[model samples]
Target: MDVEEENIESDASHNSNELGDTQRLHITKYPSQFRALANKFAHEKNLKDRRKLLEMYGNHLISFKRSILLNRKRWQQRYLRRQSFLRSVFMQQLLELETTFLELIPILNLNGMPSKNDLRINHSSDVCTPITRFYKDLLKLESDDWLAKFHMQKSTFDWLCGQLKENGQFLGKNSLMGKEPPYERQVALGLYAFATGIKYLEIARIFKITLRTTICRIMKSVAESIIKTFGDQYLYMPTSEEELDEIGEAFYSASKMPPVAIGVLGVCEVPAKQQVNSNSIESENSTIILQVLVDNNMIFRKVKLDTNQPSLFLEETNEITNLSPKLIKNQPVSRFIVTPDTYYPLRKSLMHKYHDPVEPHEYDFNEAVDHLFIFRDRALQRLFARWRILKCNGDIDLRTMEKVVLACCVLHNVIERNEKTFNEQWSKGPHSDNTKYTMSSRFKPVLNELHGKPHSWKADGASETRKLLGQAIYSTEM
Candidate 1:
């Protein structure tokens, strides 16, 4: 019975081993198939996850597209509303302009067109028009009163008219119309326009010009005539010894500062049109520099308009080199006594050198006097003040700007020469002198004298000149 049980147990173990071997054989023979099955299951799970992700992305894309369409629609609506508002504003402005035009039409008397004969007759009958009355008043007024009103004495005006006629053929008998506005009337219009800084339209209305263009043409012609006729004659540097002597004498009389051909040098900032090459729109509001030299009498002897700052011109011309002590001491000194405010090379011996006046005790008596002379001798400042009053209010082209400024300077000189008229007009003036003088803080520091340069001179001579002058003055005071 025990043997039988052992056989059974061996058979059972054999059966169990056979079963295990069969399972191992199956796994070894189909290894690739098992792996393929595992990979296939993993791929299916990955596809399911990808499908969920695609659905979520598709939903978001749809929402994004809808939002884009809504934004586009909103922007379109805003653009339409903006267009409608602009259109309404434009229409309102147009309606206002039309109303103004209609109001002016009746006043202008453009309802009915008159025949040429009737127009001529009416024009002749209206001989005592406002323009005519103004001309009559100008004629009746005295030289001082006329100068006060027009900025030119009657004699100077007549002389200018004569000069213009002789040199520029200005206001001569027009070949077609034979002097339409007449000589005196044309000159009066120009002078009045310049002195008052009036626009062409206002001048046209005052002069009874049918078109503003006519007044503009007349003013332009007059300015050109003035420039062509008198630019070289009046606005010139002293070339001859006699001329230099006269200018030096004038300077000495004014400030007791001898050998100064010109009293002051400065840059005047005048409003002008934007240059062609300038890209800045704000440059239209900026000013251009007008470099000028004036005598003791405030007459502009030299004028130059430059796009650069004033110091650049001084450097370019080597003005410091020209102002050597030897050259300054030579005949017809041609030296300019500028204020300490001027930008030039600082020479210790020069009377106009920088001096701090904060501590009066530290300054010499001569230095104090120099400061006083500089402050009081403001010929350039006065010239700029007059210019401010007479300058045109609107921006003018650069080409025309120089001519206009020159013409005004000539007029200023002419007006100044008539001292009696100028004093009377200035004292009993219809317009008050409202010009304010302000010193510019923008300036380059004084340059040092160049070494090993032939033009360079020691400041010793300048010091001696100042010392001698100071001693002379002190002796006279004593």
Candidate 2:
């Protein structure tokens, strides 16, 4: 079974490719390079040696094939078995990945990479030296154990067996390393669960174990293995210019177009259960407000006042007065504008704060999304695709025409829903027909206006040019 013979066997399987399924074929039936490797290393020299080699390789191949088949089977079976279990596992894994990934997102920000000065050792930090010393000492001992465990193979067992035959004291040498083998089954099952979005509790039911124990075992094993294998390799702040450039490139690639003028709005929602007390009732109310920032093709230039202690303020301070002196002196293509009915009033002292040179006031958020939608309609009218207004968590709930239409505005960045208004309206409703007509009629022309814009034929062809991106950033501060 050389490479040429392996290809011949693979060509045989090609005939069944039209069957439109590959899972049914056992892996051993499809020849691989491993077969040649196995034959070259086979124990015997006779004709029977080749047969024995094939048999051993066949078993290994079958195990590999079963692993693949089981993955697809588990995904299809997950929903039918236990729905709650699957949902929890999916949510947990998704959240875990999201949280970890976002921490590194500042690296991908429009602002250039942090300087060497930024990452320079802070000798002033009291705990840094002690923590570094502790980890350095610990890793030495841990590395030895890891290396020893990793290399203990069947050869080690065979060596011990030979020693046992020569001396009585070494009779149980093979049994000296009495530690149980690693939980390969648990690791395999955990990965299967992750890839297929299967729940540990459902897996527990399949394996005849308790739900709690199964979940604990799967998470501990899977998370620990992932940490040990990768171990903060990709989990670092970008300190170098090249690394920062790579991060920015990834962001630009994901975002497609550089955000012309970025409008960031944070929404905070509180659960119903937390609203029992009066103070909690007020606190449970979700807050939604917009932040105006200048996002050129490059980094996000946050307009801050000199007196403002780099505050993450939700209140929208007035644009003309509160901007940095340089921005006021030379307004860029974009100018920042905070909503008037903001949580607070724009103070007089705040008005005279540091203003940087801005690309004079030829830009605003009012026209940004609206302009995009207008462009979307003219250029993308012929496209056929489902238009969804997804929530922050990516749940699409477009049940009504108003919901559908509103979602279109949000998706295309035409009109941002006043979250407070929508929430109040939705919550106060008594399922009145008049209310539906009122809301729908009010926003109907807005949608019609969006759809009625003229197209420029000289530009790109009438393809799906405007692929709408709708991101709802929710605030967890509440």
Candidate 3:
């Protein structure tokens, strides 16, 4: 048996050696295959463990996701609540601020209540105490000085004041509360200041008024009052036959001609500053033409103003044509006769004696008689020069100028009627014989036919009238 065992052992040893050798050979030949098989087995084991872990934690993951979603929703709700609370607080604050501002408005004294000094400066200075003092000073002046300054005597001023008071409906009373200036004083100051062309500042100083605008208002009020009071009384045509006869007699006395000679026609040039409306027509000499008709007594029968010199003559004729038919009762009164220097239209009815040297005798005779008629124009000129306001040398517009002239004319008539003697300065004797006739460019050839077409019959009638008048005039010596 021992021998058999020994044999078996030897064989096993040999087999073991053979196996080892074979294994070595395989490893050397296929090492990559061995490594890949090992890796595949390890990966499969890891995948199996991971799948087990996923199965175990699946419920936990779902619960965690739900909890996160709920927490996020809670945070969002908290944020919205905080924003709403802030907005409400801001609105409440704004409302409170608005209420506070409203409550404080009345308590804030913005313009500091006017002091006593301010009241005195504003009200007392403009009231009537100063005016009373001014009137007292005016009364202290002599009658001649008063007349020279104010263009009317004290008695006349008082009469005018009384008349205006009697006709108080025309000049409304001053509504100012504090003792107001007397109506007479206000009217006198306005008339004197405007007629004399005194500066507003100068007038304010004289009257002790505080404001220049006050003087201006006073002037305008007084002027309108005067016009309303005396316009119709003084500025009307002789209405009755008796008045017409009287005017006719005055004319006959003036010219030594027949009663047919009623008035003289004339023009005066008033220089004015440039007007604001550029489209308005302006004369070449920058003047406004004033056409005036004066009766034998040197009273303004008619007055018209034209923008240009050329239009003045036509306007005068139109005025005369309108007025003549109303005045004359006998015939249609084809036209009227006047001693117009050369500017007047030469119609059969309107006879103009030329100032040519050839007709010396006729010229001399006419000149001697024409002097009486021409005196009216000279007197009118002097009257205009006397009223500086009517002349309007300063900045005055057309409307204001018209008012000034009309007012002055009314005042002129008033003074003329009231005064016993004529003012020597305003009314000098007849113009000198050596005075030369001045021709104006206003007389153009186109304007010659303005008086309408002349007929032979009209000319014959006018000539006969003139001849009879000339015979009558020459028969009587001046």
Best by TM-score: 3
In order, candidate lDDTs are 0.50, 0.29, 0.53
- Give candidate 1's error at residue 394 in angstroms: 3.0
Clashing pairs in 3: none
Residue 311, candidate 1: alpha-carbon lDDT: 44
- Per-prediction TM-score to the true structure, in the order listed: 0.57, 0.22, 0.58
Q: List where candidate 2 sits over 4 angstroms from the true fold.
A: 1-181, 195-201, 205-211, 249-478
Segments of candidate 3 deviating more than 4 angstroms: 1-119, 123-132, 166-182, 210-214, 276-288, 309-339, 348-351, 357-361, 420-478
Model 2 scores a C-alpha lDDT of 0.29
Per residue, candidate 2 scores C-alpha lDDT tens digits across 1-478 of: 4664565456445533433255436433446546554656555577876777777777756665564556456545654445645554565577556445433322211234545533323343211111112112323545333223221122322332243234312111121111222233343333334322334334343322233333344434444444333223322223344543453334334333222112221111111111112332112212111121212122112322111112333233433334322121122212122222122222221111112313212122222333322322321111001111111112111122122222122222211111111112221222221321011111111111112453331232211111111111011111
Report the number of the highest-lDDT candidate.
Answer: 3
Writing each residue's lDDT as its tens digit, candidate 1 over 63-176 gives: 534544554565566667667666655654664574454334321223344344333223332121121344665678886576565655677777777777677644433311
- Residue 427 error for model 3, in Å? 8.9
TM-score: the better of candidates 1 and 3: 3
User: Tens digit of lDDT per residue, candidate 3, span 131-194?
Assistant: 1345666778898776677666888877888887766332334422124446866776767765
Model 1 clash pairs? none
Name the better of 1 and 2 by TM-score. 1
The candidates, ranked best first by lDDT, are: 3, 1, 2
